[model samples]
Target: MPSLSPPPVDKPSDATTAQTTEAETKPHAQPDSDEPINSLDPQPIDESKPKSNLDLVNECDSFPYFQSTPQLYLNHVSTYYHLRVAAYPEITLGYVLPSVAEVLRGLEEWELDDDERTLTLKAGDDEPTRSAILARTTAAMREIGHFSILKGWRNELYPVYGPAPARDLLFSIERAASALFGIVTYGIHMTAYTKSESGELKIWTPRRSKTKSTYPGMLDNTVAGGMATGENPQICCVREASEEASLPEDLVREKAHSAGTVTYFHIRDSRAGGETRLLQPECQYIFDLEVPSDVEPKPSDDEVEEFYLMGVDELKEKLKAGEFKPNCAVVLLDFFIRHGVLNAQNEPDFIEIVSRLHRKLDFPTA
Candidate 1:
């Protein structure tokens, strides 16, 4: 799990140019240049100093370069192209930047609809066919050096579900490439805590291994992971609890409780591999487990360095200090909100913070 450094994009040879199609000649599909035509990169946030509770929330839900206003972030998404499949006209599977749309022209499978302002993937109805086409096209993009984001690609697959209420599986995409497509990805995050004899609450937090490709050496939730293509939240939670935190399946099943979800649209920064400012709409299924005092959480894999049992006050200090991963910080904030720790009486931006934590996504989700 060493830090992933994207391979340098070599200039395309004459043979590579021969693969280009008529779609490349379209107005939106502009050729690559020394300088970008329309940059979709988001404004930067200073991560060096201590931030307020609201500031931490803004870090994960960061968007709308003009101001840090939360509502504007949602509005900003309108500017991106709607990513859809041919049959599913009503459902938006993902969002794509015009810059990304131009890159998709390199792949033969994707069809760009100029009138609809969409980049549609051309494939059949079957999941296997859609998955295979996406897999092949993304692999081709990786091989041809389409974008740096694909370089951090995990071989793992993330499902892009069709409609919100139905949650039908549309297709699957590589984990890293999902951000490039601006899709809604799901994950599971659990906050494991314990109470002393006096009822003083302490939560378990883990530090990610420094060798990790993204967000190395950062603080994460007690147990967390991405929900694979067919995995449900509860199963993902139990599995991650075992793999990441060494908590036994029976223990997790007996003690862990689903606490709902924390949704946020995050823009990647330099620490996240590949192109900075790529959009990532995520929904983390939240769980809370009050472990028995004797049950100590330990790192079961290289993904984590160590686990720390921190008091509520200490956790607050670390959160404001910007010590946790951006999305994980939002997850922790949700935990505080749910547990009545971060209340309206104490936090001034209580209402705003709560709303942003459960930010409504434009794309269909589970």
Candidate 2:
């Protein structure tokens, strides 16, 4: 395990800034600051606009620097949060970034106001120290091959659809004229399946976490996790399943069944804490996983309590009762309707989509 402590929030002083050197804000330094606009980096900011000067303290707070320090894994949380540069197909060092342990000793430590929230780093003993920390952290991340500690701090933050990188890494953003930080969101659904006595297949439903970020204490499909910076949908599936249930990577990778791209562009879940900065927009990439009926499930206590197995009629009744999370309900119904598992008589929407797909494949309509 790497050190979880981040520096306390404070601006570097003349002794800190003057003594410390600034890193070159290379396009490759940040999580989403890559070569193309459509790439991982945030969209370009129009710098032709005017600037504002509102401050009494230091400027470092406006342009925070992290040592690409590995984020701390808080107690009881399954997800990992830490800063690193964005991961991409570029190269400065070969594969295998250095461990955070290598640079841990050199970091000047500080603590936030005793009762304040959000732990941050405060180390810039000198320009060389600052430069060395940033540069070395960048290089270490480059070697580790997990993520990068973004370079350019002065950029505009923009709204994006999914993960920052096609991988899972962390970065920091400070208030700047360029708007350094931004947010990404994700969603998941589990499609449990079993063979009927006659050899038909189906799915199972689980109860949601009463303590969940959204739709607390309701029933759900399986599990889901947002794609962090440098992550992908398939990766989200694997990660979410692992967090929610004891799903082996192989099963998630199997791709036995799929309900592609069920999304809600304006969905919001207020239960999500500050990790999402409370901007739990209605955004997610939904998927359905049909598992073998007899395959017992292992769920995470932090996320779920328990679940039940039900056939089409039972599931439909649950759906009508509005017992499941709205998004999960959408994905589940879509899954059954997609796999020919359901009769497609649920509503006009199901009938329409089913008929369209069946006819597209030249199959006789039921």
Candidate 3:
């Protein structure tokens, strides 16, 4: 009956924790040292990659980017509105707003929570970018009215089938990660370790390059992204560590090692099945980052085509033989049992992680 863990927390040297994970500046222009995107006959831009924000999305007849505001209703049966002095979505890459969401009316399937997709509306009541009304967002959503990907009931109400859509409309994950699934991604349970002398810490595992699109170059956490549409999650953790390592953006803003967060959901992807096929979207976030033992993780052979390091008893013996990615072995056994370097044991290699952290510290019994 001995299991407590919640103490060891020292890691702070890389310059008082660096901070500034992508403060929005180079969000659009960064793969242009020349823009041939690599060739000599290796073309794979496949084209079709524009899910939302083709100029802030408003569509047609003088869509300049919103300005109108004067429509209300409640006792008359609820139906107020705004955002139409010009309309937006001119495409900048489905994001880059300061005013635009609140495009209400049942939030068009909000990834599928269906309370008619729920939406009340706000975010540019007059005009000037704040955007956040994807239509009432739920109550049984069905296409929050119109943003047209080629309208006329956008393919028979699409996944208007209800109970999903708080955010899933991909359009390119091969067919769009399981039919647009409910889009709002961000995972990076990273590992590329270094630092050992009995002072221990060594991780680096990679082996997933099925010409990746997601899980293709799957080793686990080599910097991840998907928070677009007016982003801000420390700018998707410095735009996923400089788009998959080689470090230096002033050493990720000067060392600043260790930080954490994680959430989950996934689907077998169909990859843009005809534009965002009948979605299945349902996923959250995950961050966990901790660098500098002598920092040297520079892999982006076009998004991690695999690598390897080892230690922390070989990342707890390859996550107890399951070989990573169950949310990256629950984030490297929760950052090596929160930075003490994995201890608790009873043999059979840490007795099923102390019976899964004693069903996760549910302590109370006497």
Candidate 4:
């Protein structure tokens, strides 16, 4: 069957137009009154060289910038904020609360110091109440158009794991920004593999539904989702298995095995503005399920479009061809490494690839 491509949906243009108008109205003084004012001319463009598969893989396996590090390429000055009550280092802001004004308006538990631009949770606020307060704030942001609900579910709190005594919760989807605040967001990814009658290994992969806001139509693991508040990694794996694929609870519970984890820190441009950046520090709890040869996965939820059982060799070729989602590729790479498909002798940069798979994020534990 021919591949079905979903129609493209245009992003809302109102905010962009408003920002452009505001920027245009800002007064610009002529450098020299004596000299005729000249319009800014566009500079010549330098063509970028194409990246190899190794380069692309390495690019995905990168670390987030430290708060103290300068991002000179940004058009505007970047600001770092900190939590006043803790000795945590300054954190670069991302999507959750863009500015101090919004932060003050949305969260009642948070106290913001205008002079220092730091925010802190109210003293003596317990975890249960803090979670309740954040949920209310998230709802208000959604109502006022500051945040969009993803996947049609109410915003959920996700746990941020640290070294010892430090534990906190942030909205599940907003964990990207939470990570920028030096928190660790945990998730789960499960791969279903089977052996064909001819004795060839095959892996089941799914195409993410096009309705997904991020990485729509991209290929993904058989089952995956963020570990939500009050949910353990194993429970998350079983839940995602049933949701993303039509796997029965008994099958998932019986066949799945803990396969280790993949951790990484990634930085990317934010939708808020060109100068804004998103820091994502994440760890995925990996699970492997060996299914019967005759059993095939069917999409049970809107998260997955279709499932395909491809030969291991074919999956590797597709992975190298950049067909899978960036993070999903990392998960698959981890699988290949463990299964002996990828080795130091076969892949050039094996040590670097393995090292980058586990990034050391400086989560504030003190």
Candidate 5:
């Protein structure tokens, strides 16, 4: 198996600027800087033109990025077609771009429907058979060396469950190609925080390693990882807390509370290291870990550079500045809402923001 550790951190550049090194300020911002944004120094809010946090929500759930209607969104996806497995013909499984579909059509494993708009994988009803066919197909595509997304393949598998009411497993696909198929992927994101005696709250945020592939040098939640096949949400959270934050598994199991979920449909940008504009609908299982004041998060792997404990005020400023990864920002907003930091009294779009955070995805979810 390929080693999971990223390349060693690159030497810091002498001419790095805030605009270039700033984390997730833009969807595809470059990661040339490692300087952390000082959360203690708050920026002055322009009272003349107040900004809404709803913009952050919209950026993460970018299905409406173009400010278009549902029909328009579907129209924009004209170049891609729906994917289905022969075992369940009535339900759509995923999507395939024209180029990807062209390759599938030439392969014997896939059978294009009469409409020419849907491609179905021909396999037996068993889960192993379905998974074998998909594994073979994706492997062949990877060997062809034509698709850029496959170049960064993680060699990990993500389980694809059938639509609601049918919880049986359908198949599994490579983690890197999950977005290319436009399928609903699952992950766990935990927010580690501390509450002082005076009731003041602070959160632990980590700066991603500069050498990482996706969102390098960006800020992320205390602990986060994709849900591998056969792992529950809590198990994934516990494993990530140990691997990413160097926290003890027992402590994580004891402190981490299930805080519901944050769902969003994101379009991949250049920063995500794949075909730009690809669809990636995801459901992030959320957890909130309340650590004692004495506990601190440290970088356990090359995926993280450093951890910062910041107050709510500083977090707000960074949020407005777009310093956190898009989904990580969304998850933080959800934490703020649940903790009563954001409410109708202060945020005018409170209802809309809450509504958007739990978007009803069209695809199947666990």
Candidate 6:
């Protein structure tokens, strides 16, 4: 496991600035209103655009840097709350009102100022106790219908990553609202692919269950899960493979390979209360599992409705048609790049796409 200590933070250099400019030109979808609409629909590649791939990448990587603004705004109902950077006191991360902050403060170790409308989390607190407090708060909120909790499941703790990675435990999956206040979260995704005897590559995809609280009935990867606190990426992959796809342990242990990672900032619009949920600094540790052509995945968990094996061409067409989750599409793009399916020789925006796919994220760890 890598050390949790943060690397020294630095300002974005000229090269980064140039890359940002080149990458922002591609058209990416944003929510038109406060609805959880799918925004990862593949846009028609405009040959007239000099930097098309950059735009594609930027659409998925939407979170702005903490230093870029004095404060970040979060909307709830008709009100907007400002969240300021916890470290750089002058900069705002985003906003939340006192009442909202109070609901969060009901948990342990949260510091909020009504006057400044700022929030900070105390680090190095007792893990078990903090977890308990958060769990109780989550239960209370779920009772009042703030969000639905997975039945019989406890909230999983996730480490907080930032300029100064805190040893202090951060929010759990249930309290993901805390992430919008400028915390970074992590998830794991696995791409299971196999090749036919004729050498055609096919991918294993799953449709999310209609009962899912988010992205119900949307297309997802073969297996995906959040990286709970104290769980490593490999452990997460193995567990999700079993729970979501009913893959045997031995098959996953031998076939799963750490392919790389993709990070982005996204905001999910909520139609329930006309609010927007912020996904600040989310990183997906991607893995590729080359399963045998004969192996079939059976959906073992309620999270998935069904699984299918689709050829790469069909997958691409479905992706462009907005059939897949936005983030899942980005992961597929990374797979395409690594497999040589997308390259400069074939794709005009190869450089920009490649660069944006591997955008440099400021994770707390080195």
Compared with the true structure, the alpha-carbon lDDT of candidate 1 equals 0.75
Q: Candidate 2 residues 1-366, lDDT tens each? A: 223333332221111001111111111122321222111111112224421111100110111113221111011001101211222211111001012222333444422221111112355433334334444443433344332232322232222221323422222222110011122333455576676779665566688767655457877776655454345667768877777777777887785344555532121223222211111122355565667655666776677788666777777666656566555665665576567655535344554333322111000100
lDDT of 4 at 212: 71
lDDT of 5 by residue, 1-366 (tens): 111122232222222111221111211212233333222111223424434598778767876422334323333333345677777765666555556666665456677652445677766678888888777777777777667898889888998878668777888888887876777889999999999999999999999999988878878999999998899999999999999999989999987999999998877776677566667788999999999989999988899999999999999988887777889989999999999999999999999899899987756677
TM-scores, each model vs. reference: 0.84, 0.44, 0.24, 0.71, 0.83, 0.69
Measured over all alpha carbons after superposition, the RMSD of each candidate to the real structure, in angstroms, is 7.6, 17.9, 22.4, 10.9, 12.1, 10.5
Total backbone clashes of candidate 6, pairs 3 or more residues apart or in separate chains:
15
Clashing residue pairs in candidate 1 (N, C-alpha, C atoms within 3 angstroms): none
Worst 10 residues of 5 by lDDT: 20-29
lDDT of 4 by residue, 91-206 (tens): 32221222423334334456655344345555334555544554554444334443232223334556643234544432233442343343456789998998767877778999
Residue pairs of candidate 5 with colliding backbone atoms: none
Model 6 scores a C-alpha lDDT of: 0.57
Among all candidates shown, the one with the greatest lDDT: 1
The per-residue C-alpha lDDT of model 4 at residue 347 equals: 84
Model 1: per-residue lDDT, tens digit, 148-170?
A: 78777789999988774677888
Ranking by TM-score: 1, 5, 4, 6, 2, 3
- Global fold similarity of model 6 (TM-score): 0.69
Ranking by lDDT: 1, 5, 6, 4, 2, 3
Error of 2 at 149 (Å): 26
Write model 6 residue lDDT over 1-366, tens digit each, in one string. Answer: 111121232221111011121111211212124432223222323425332334445555654443442122111211323333234343333333333454554334456554433555443345454445445644554454433222324355666432334433433434344443434567789999998778889999999888776657778989988887778899899998999899988889888999988877655434111234444556799999999877889998688888999988788777656566667778888998999888889888787667666655433431
Better-scoring candidate (TM-score), 2 or 3 = 2
